[model samples]
Target: MSDKLPQNRNNEEVDLLVLFDYFGKSINRVINFFYKIIKGIFSFFIYALKPFIRNFKLIASVVLVSAILGFIIQKTQRDVYTSQMLVKPYFDSKYQLVTNIKYYNALINEKDYAQLQEIFNISEEDTKQIISFDIHSGPENENDKIVQYDEFLKSIDSSRAKNISFKEFVENRSIYSGDVFQIEVFSHKKDIFRSLEEGLNTTFTNTYSVKKMQKRDSLISIERQNILSSIKQVDSLQKVYIDVMNDEANSNKGSYTTKDGMSFIQERTKTKEYELLKESMQLRQALSELDAQKVEEDVYFDTLSSFQDTGEKYTSIWRVYTLIFPLAAFVTLCFVFTGKNIIRFIVNYEA
Candidate 1:
């Protein structure tokens, strides 16, 4: 048994050596594969740079001429000015407001200066200066978002509400979901914004919004009449309860003896006048709230902030073509060289 043990140990050592050799070869192959990928990427980058390196002078001249042309255009174009107004619309008038803003943009695009003149009540020359109109939701804090989310949850089905989280609700909400909106107008004339406000003001009172407002007022009137009637009934019941108690006190009879000579204890009656009073107070409070709501939202829309008399000069990064032209020229040259090389490769290729 001792003699066989050494031979067995030698065979085990040989097997381990073979396994280690196989693993080392596999690791070497993986390393070689990654190395080849890195080398090929570096070679391709150098090849791409060769054309730009060889034709540096020509590329520089083209880029310089394009930059000069862009600078000239930038200097010659008319300057733009922009102004903003904030508004809170009631009775879903925001829908009409957004629609009107789009209509204004369309009119501007179509260059219907005559129609624009009628709408804004401005001269044809002033209307020609108008560039664009835009509207988007105004700023709101987290608490406002939470309140809106709660309302949205209540407005939908309970099963669907369970699948929606607060973050999801906020992310999915549209511009019309907001209660306030900011209207922006762009024009070449700095003072043109103030004149556009009158036209914008007319946008919030469409036929739909008018009917909705009337319906709300009618409902409030009905509710007010019902609450007043309830208060009157409660008052009458209270008066009857008071009279009954007063009469009982004056009777001076705690217990009465029957003809059988059996004396019975008198059981005083209980009145829920206190509960009735609480109900009356609650009803009155609800009625007051309804009146307050109607008073606050009577108008079609409220202007939180009006447009400035003179708009500020507007600038955009996209308008800075002095720097843009040179970059664009470089990219265009790269594409041209790449195409030339491909065509040459195809012509010289031997299938």
Candidate 2:
């Protein structure tokens, strides 16, 4: 039994050694597999980069010439001095304003100075200096969902909106309400930009009001007139009540017993004056709000963000080219060189 035990122990040791050896070999295989993958990746990059490195002189020459041309062009370009008015225009769709800009631009490009002056009130010289009239908006792009501006919009809808149903209005509501928008103008001539800004603002202010807003404006006007008329009528009635009280007092507010024992002045005019005064006060209160409401025939813009001369202008033009040119040149070189190499290799293989 002892001898058999020794033999079994030796066999167990041999099995343990074999197991360890197998596990070690498995780990080595896994590590080698990953190493080869990484090595192959580095080798591929090295091979691909070698040809580009060999042609460094050519690539450098092309890049240098492109950079020099870009610099020359940038220098020759006139520095566009600009003025801007960041006004929030009143319009249903911002695109409407954008379309208007394009139309006005077309008018300018056509050299219709008379037409431009009539429409936008800008002079021929102003139109010539004006580079662009543009509109911009937030990231809530054309297709983006427009979340409600909150319950304020809903309440406004309930109060004034009529052309669209409340349900349709709520359903169709987008982030953009015409109450606020941006108007941007770009031009080289500072004087022209300044005058054109005011001209365009006035021109836009006279544009047609939306149907619902027009309806609301008419209603307000009617209501205001009605309130004023009622105030006049109520004042007259109040004066009559006061006159009756005065006459009664003049006759000696003294009560006398009749044969029927009913007092005439006291019974008739007792609460009448008080009631008339109370009602007149209420009508005046209602009429006060009507007077306070400033109604207009057309919707207009309020400049929420003011125009700063510096905010409108971009930084050094060279700075823009700094980031832009190198990347552009690199991409162009890669395309040309790679294509040239591919065509050359194919031609050689064919030969």
Candidate 3:
């Protein structure tokens, strides 16, 4: 039995050995297959990259040429824009009144040629010079007038009129219900900014004045209603007192002596009430007068607020544009270059 057991153990050991050898062979076959596949792919990429690697100088020259062409094209065709400005009047907050946004928008859309010409200080003869008006609206008598105005804008000897529209030049283009205004002037020549600044300042000053007057008229109407309400209340109280006195006098019936004293008291009371009523009526009239003065003061305050808000908005909007445009251009350029270089490197490495 011991000998038989030893033989059995030997057989079992042989079977175990056979199983281990089979697994080792399988593993070796898999590893060799993968290794060969990786080597083939690597060789293929090396073969493809051999041409570009051999011509590093030529590739560098091509890239340099492309960059130079891009720079030159950008520099030569640069749009030389000249801008001039016209400022819309802001809403007057001191008067607690704001311009209707829809009305303001419509006013902007309707391009007032006459007003624009006046603001730009363009003369009729100068209007014949170099202006081209592209009216978005249908043809109207104003089209010719606008064309004339355009010519005048172009005729200005200052660089402000060159290669830019009055509309394009203004930095702030927002229309707000509350006090806010802006004007932008652009020109290829830096010299034109001074002239545009002076002209726009004057024009905006006049516009603010006119808008103030209109707001003043509206506020006056409100004050007038308040005064009228006070007057009506006084009149109503006076009527009630008068009716009470009449009813009391009609109810009283007695000897002349008895009635005399009561009549005196009643007369005294009625006189006092009448005097009070008269004073209140006078106060209403006085308020009406005061409203007139307040209207003028409101007009002044509204004009000042309009000017200040307009100046602030102009500064803020222009500052944003100055930062945004350059930053956007720079980021766009970086994205383009990084994407191109990364793709090129990846393809070359793979090849």
Candidate 4:
């Protein structure tokens, strides 16, 4: 048994040695295969870049010429500056405020100077070169009903737009409370920018916004009358009931009974009358509060943020060169080299 044990141990060692030697050979084969692939890739890149390297001087000449040309052209362009103002739209007329931008834009486009002057109180000179008047709004809470509807339509059609046509986008959506919106005025001159901003504020107040507020006032007045009428009718009905109860008690001469349809002292009838009176008073209070609000909120143009446009800096010569020089130079170099090579290719093929 001892002899057999020694022979078995020797066989196991030989098997282990054979396994390790096979693994080493397999690993060497994989390394050599990957090394050959890397060497081929490196050679391909070197050959592909040979043309660009050979024509380096000519490409450099092209880059210099193109960079200089770009610098000059960009320098000649006008620097347009934009002035922005922020305001919170009126709660009730928020939808109208956005819709009216389209109406205002039409006046600007038509060159109806007389009406524009009256609405905005701007001079003829101030209107010159007033590039555009625009309104921009940020993303509001998704929970807002108007925003939800807007999102839904945009999801379905992908083009829910506003202030672009006579049929305003707001006509389809709800209005939220005092949504903050931005007003931008673009112009070539800073003076015109300031003038346009002031005039826009005036136009919003006197023209579009005032008309909406007046309409709202008319609606509130109608509601007030309805509520008052309701209160008066309720009071009249209560008075008749009390009168009937009193007459029945008097006629019975202190012998009130359920059999005769009269309760002792008629407490339940008084309680019901009291409830009606309480409801009427509440309606009156609501009307009064609404009137007070109209007084305060009748006017428009609640400017939330007002800051003068920080004047734009004219493009410096070096700054302009820095922005355009490198990019123009690189693209021009690539194009010139590639184009030359393409022409050479066609000529060789013809030959």
User: Which lDDT tens digits does candidate 3 get at residues 1-351?
Assistant: 989999999999999999999999999999999999999999978865665576566656655555565556554642333333323243333122123223223433564445444544654333222122111111225454456447657667658667565455333322331232333332233333343343334422345566776776777778777777877777777788888777766765322345456433334243457676777868777786867676555433222211121211123333344344445554555465557767888889952
Q: How close is candidate 3 to the true structure, as a TM-score?
A: 0.30
User: Candidates sorted by lDDT, descending order?
Assistant: 1, 4, 2, 3
C-alpha lDDT of residue 278 in model 3: 73
Candidate 4: segments with Cα more than 4 A from true spot: 1-14, 29-67, 87-128, 131-134, 138-180, 197-219, 233-281, 292-321, 335-351
Q: For model 4, how does the per-residue alpha-carbon lDDT over 38-116 read when each residue is reduced to its tens digit?
A: 9999987885578779877877776677777776877686676677778765744455556666666776788776776
Best by lDDT: 1
Task: Put down candidate 1 lDDT per residue, 1-351, tens digits, no spaces.
Answer: 999999999999999999999999999999999999999999999988899899999999999998998899899999999999999999999999999899989999999999889988989999999999999999899999999999999999999999999999889899988999999999999998889899889999889999999999999999999999998999999899888888777775868899999998777678888998899899899989999999999999999999999999999987888888888998999999999989998999999
Clashing pairs in model 1, backbone N/Cα/C closer than 3 A:
none
- Which sections of candidate 2 miss by over 4 Å? 90-96, 108-114, 117-123, 138-148, 151-178, 202-214, 225-286, 295-299, 303-313, 316-323, 340-351
lDDT of each: 0.93, 0.64, 0.50, 0.67
Candidate 3 Cα misplacement greater than 4 A, ranges? 1-56, 66-88, 91-119, 122-179, 197-219, 228-351
RMSD of 2: 7.4
RMSD of each: 3.5, 7.4, 17.1, 8.7
What's the true lDDT of residue 41 in model 4? 100
TM-scores of all candidate predictions against the true structure: 0.86, 0.65, 0.30, 0.55
Kindly give the stretch of ten consecutive residues in candidate 2 with the minimal lDDT sum: 138-147
lDDT of 2 by residue, 1-351 (tens): 889999999999999999999999999999999999999999988867877799898878867777777777777765565555555555443445556677877876787778767765766676676666666543344233233334435666555644555457546665344345556666666545545655565545333445545666678789878877877887887788788777877875556767998765455465366776777788788767655654322455555564553434545646456446766888887887778878888988953
